[model samples]
Target: MNSSSDSDFFDVIVCGSGPAGLSASLAAVQSGARTLLLERLPGLGTKLLASGGGRCNFSNLLPEPEFMAAFGRNGRFMTDALRTGGLVFIRSFLRSEGIETVAEDGFHCFPSTGRAASIRDAFLHAAQKRGLTVKTSARADEIRIREGAVEGVRTAIGAFSCRKFILATGGTAMPALGGTSKGLLLAEAVGHRITPPLPAMAPIPVDDPWVSELAGVSLPDARLSFTAGRLRGSCRGELLFTHEGLSGPAALSLSGPAGRAWTEHRDSFRLILEPEAETDRKIWCERIDDARKKEPDKLFRSVPGRTMPRSLAARLAALAGLEDRRNRELKNADRDRAASLFAGIPLTVSRLSPMEKAMAMSGGVVLTEVNPKTMESRLVKGLFFAGEVLDLTGPCGGYNIQFAIASGRLAGENHTGTLPLEKQG
Candidate 1:
């Protein structure tokens, strides 16, 4: 932070103050480039401040291959970005800035102080020391271009000229955090094709009222699966029933893929929730039989009730039409129905969490339009993009933030390093 008023020009300008923009500014300044960072919000990193319930799970420590896989098919787009500022670099960068990080669960990394401010402050401190100018409450509305190259950016305050610019404004997942389409619109106006964004990492708002009835109940280890059109994904973890629909890790992680599929086949979209995910149908049948033998007169609800929350078990039993029957009274058809229900309960998905309620989103700038190698626009010189603006999305557990920081650093470093061939010519 150059806390003083803005200058008319700089070597680089970063639009957005989220993790990616912060990293870009810091990297540019660290490389001796006169840099300016503009943020639309009054404060920086609003979404970041709310991340991980404010603990800010910032990175993951998995090996590169597995790490990339977490981001799905387009995960490989982050190869160069991650290589430039991966887990090791981030940990070292934080440590050098007097902030230490720890993977509290031996996976997701967070600041030792357990505050998002720690990471944001570290970047601010480091970047300011290197002369990075700051402007908040300033939104970049247009990118001035000349001969297919970025010249400067126009903001509400004023126009700032820059040889290089980085766009890391993120997606429209949370409007309260100032998430908007301005960034995407800015890129689109400059020739980059944007993939329509979809709300993700949020609960699925099902139309089924029975799930709402089981609100406050959770299956600690359940598998959520969805298959519709081009969408196919599954995750096993906690599945929580909410007043509106489903929440918890399993649902959140599956929400992205599920949303994509559901949006396409809204009327036919169906999900399967496996309460006994680890136990196959055969095993479930055996358990039900054991319950039948040991408690012949027990209500059939006690079958699944033994392994899961009684309320949910009772609901599933009711769904399977055995709630009022006893164990000994179950016909073979009832047995098969109960076992199948326990194995994989069919759930019709009516809608996904809206953008305003989402924690993250899937889809962004089409990956093909930008070079992950340098985070530069393939169609426009001196214009770089990073973070959630890209098409790649990962599961929960800090994957999103990790990519943001890494991609930002890579974009910053390369954007300010060498002049483009067109410029040189």
Candidate 2:
């Protein structure tokens, strides 16, 4: 509700200054468009600075097919944008900004400097160098739509007009970094269909107090399976015990489906941690047999050290009622019990962590409402969306950033071509 008399217009206006917004602004400016980048926070890329434990994992080097697979079912929607603006382009862009990248395990890429701030500064520098006008502490109050086309955005300061608007306002994650549902609300007011937002890439809440007692214990090479009543799926990697529940790669990957399942079937939702190698019960049985003969003095719980964390091993053993007994003291039934415990350590998942604790959100503008090729809104002319705001969230790692930058670039480059706003009437 601010005055607009002194507001300046631009060829392109981008809301939010996260990875997607900055990337879009950069692309727009590079394309010879007068661009304005608006952010609600006092500084830009607040969330980016906190990613990858303070070292921004920019993108992954995997092929498009492999990269897309990480996104699950919504992966295909990103094929077009990624094909045009994929990891290759992102790597090249970062290099151009003098922020070199190095590929780590699983083809995950991070800044050579190992500092997320470096990547953030690089984006800000690029945007400034390209003459993109950036306005911080400028939250968009509304998207001014006239005749079914975007006229401009109304901010706290005033109304700023633009030929095209890019809503890269991000999803409702990391609220401390300025994420809110306002972006979805703005889109909805303009006739865009929004997918109900839910927490994704978040930690699962376990009610067991023993989990908190084991906080800081991390298990690598473990597989986590999430089961909601009859539905079940599994992810294999690492898990870290937190005071509230479980976190880390495997736990985060299963959070989305687990959260959804928990909502529908609150009575029963479980997280099963199995030794990565013993995913096959036969293999576990053989290992149990070997342990019984070779290391009879070793506790049954100690057997999991070959597969899970020492802490997890002890917990599993205790769960199977074999923590006190030595491996040699185990009867044949005890061996079966130990194997069962090692194969799947079930933790009752109570619920999802709050949105503020979520790494990313699952829902946003439905994909069908936007053109996958250009990221332009089919319902609202001259308006486009990218990043977590688009109901296209992928698993944790570098996939989310890749999707954000790819979609941003695509929307920026295709903005003008998709802006036949006069027909919106």
Best by lDDT: 1
Minimal lDDT window, size 10, model 2: 416-425
TM, every model: 0.96, 0.90
The residue pairs found clashing in candidate 1 are 1-128
lDDT of 1 at 63: 96
What would the TM-score be for candidate 1 when compared with the true structure? 0.96
Per-candidate local distance difference test: 0.86, 0.81
Error of 2 at 392 (Å): 1.6
Per-residue CA lDDT of model 1 for 1-425, tens digit only, reads 33554446777889999999999998888777788899988898889888988989988889999999978788899999899889989999999978888886788899998899889889988998888889998999999899999998999888878889999999989898877888899999998888788988989887788999988998888899988866678999988999998899899988887888787877667798897679778998888788778999999988887888889888888999888999989887888878887888888776678899888879888999898889999999889998988888887889999999999999988454453212211
lDDT of 1 at 413: 89
